[model samples]
Target: MVTDTRLYRKVTAQAWDRLDSRPARRTAWLGYDGSLPVIAGTVICLVVQKLPGGGGNKPVEAS
Candidate 1:
């Protein structure tokens, strides 16, 4: 739970926008374990890219 109002508001707004624009990408689940609600899931990488470098791969030396 977020205690800071400003942070909470910012996160809420971002969530609302994502929910509106990408509803299909959202995931939700509800379960009970001994009268207690439990939630577990995994989040995969959303974006992956290569880093900029020279042609040949080489290790840098420290002086």
Candidate 2:
């Protein structure tokens, strides 16, 4: 979980390089400007939905 760890940095750097080198020109419009936020929000929502009592899969009943 420690981002400062060498392994984490290396893996992330490699992934970034691979993604960065893509020939897709849309990256300029999509990277941080659009897709990143949407992707991040999706990830947050999925994480919250998975947490216990986060009301993900079960329905709550009124008393």
Candidate 3:
């Protein structure tokens, strides 16, 4: 899970150019930017509410 910032920047620049050429994916990404947070929060709240022992105590697995 290591990143090289310089390579990432270079690839991202190229990807943006390529993505900008397409109307569909670009428009999808436009909505994703706004909706991701609300979606993620809802999922997290649902999981926590469903967790056993009333959600305060986190379970740690033995390594």
Candidate 4:
């Protein structure tokens, strides 16, 4: 469980790192596929996007 959580966080953080190095645009999408903590081997999806005129305030969605 702990390993899964760490891996999930690592994947998410890597996505954010890549996004941060890019130039700002009208829109952008970032997604992560990883395991969940409580559900053991079960996986989940996390998506985030930069909204129009958000000026860097991106919104995140997790499933």
What candidate 2 gets wrong by more than 4 Å, as runs, is: 1-47, 53-56
TM-score of each: 0.18, 0.15, 0.15, 0.16
lDDT of each: 0.27, 0.29, 0.28, 0.33
Model 1 misses residue 47 by how many Å?
1.2
lDDT of 2 by residue, 1-63 (tens): 112433222111111111222234565565445433222111111112143344434433421
Q: What is the number of backbone collisions in each predicted candidate, taken in the order shown?
A: 0, 0, 0, 0
Query: What is candidate 4's CA lDDT for residue 26?
Result: 26
Model 4 misplaced stretches (Cα beyond 4 Å): 1-37, 40-54
Instruction: List CA RMSD, all candidates.
Output: 16.7, 14.9, 17.7, 17.9
Using TM-score as the measure, which candidate wins? 1
| Angstrom error at residue 43, model 1 | 0.6
Q: Between which residue pairs do clashes occur in model 4? A: none
Model 4 agreement with the true structure over 1-63: per-residue lDDT tens digits: 122342223223222321223224323333423432232232334432432344544445553
